[model samples]
Target: MTPKAKAATGALTLASAAILGAMHLWEGQRLTVYADKLAGGLPTYCSGRTQPPRPVGSTLTQAECDAIDRQTATEYGRAILACIPAERMDQNSFDAMTLFAINVGKTAACNSRAAHLMRDGQRENACRALAYGPDGRPVWSYARGVYVQGLQNRRRYEMNWCLKLATAA
Candidate 1:
């Protein structure tokens, strides 16, 4: 990898810890697999992971959950950094974005207005985009067409974290 790429990777690695911590707090730990009715009954377990589908009764140890969470966060962080210049993001912003991507999906986060703003060097606006869209309404704050306070809260948290270094911007 080029020096720049290596630097980005190192930065992401440092940010991953904060991302995982936030994810654990937000997603919560479920030892047993459960059907997420809001997500069309997707089988989810271990920090909201739905991949490698397990039966509803499947269980995992704390160690397994931590490992999965780290792996998933790392994957999402790398994908996000691929689209937004890692050099443009501070640790708080990177952590917030990574957590948002984990919740909303890499493709959505990467294509979001926030990503556009970040790529355009509008760091503060990019952070604000996570909570409010172009129409000045909360984005990604719905589930099954119903407004969810939890999602709104999550967005607010991310937006705050993303803006932590904005004064320096």
Candidate 2:
């Protein structure tokens, strides 16, 4: 892969938006209302580590969302750079891990199986790590005191993308 692809800074930015869209947080900044009627605010540009700061009525414009998304990606990208050596992983793996980091929080992502695998030059397994739980069980994550499958699906998609990159030298 080229240096640009290995860095994958642009891919990370785009993937962050994709994750938000998949979670139905793409209509600007608004509350995510699940099928079960559970509600939670998910800001487009996350000022907080876990979620965006709740806006007035939990809403924001497209431009506002775009700005926040860029800022958040930059913030998370820096965190990813701090721990994970930039050249150690390919673009697909780095991008997937960065997106996961953005969703799961940088602190957790940096300490995750994916991070460990990548650091040890096990890029393929790093991508696969996204599909498993912290303990290698079924993928599941808690949100608002309830388990949500959105994360699991997102991780799986990322895992596939990372795996498609093929083995590195």
Q: Give the TM-scores of the predictions, in the order they appear.
A: 0.90, 0.66
Q: Write the per-residue lDDT of candidate 1 for residues 60-91, one digit (tens) a residue.
A: 99999988888788788888888888888877
Runs in model 1 lying further than 4 Å from the true structure? 1-10, 166-169
Least well predicted 10-residue stretch by lDDT in candidate 1: 8-17
Q: How many residue pairs clash in each candidate?
A: 0, 0
Global lDDT of model 1 = 0.85
Error of 1 at 114 (Å): 0.8
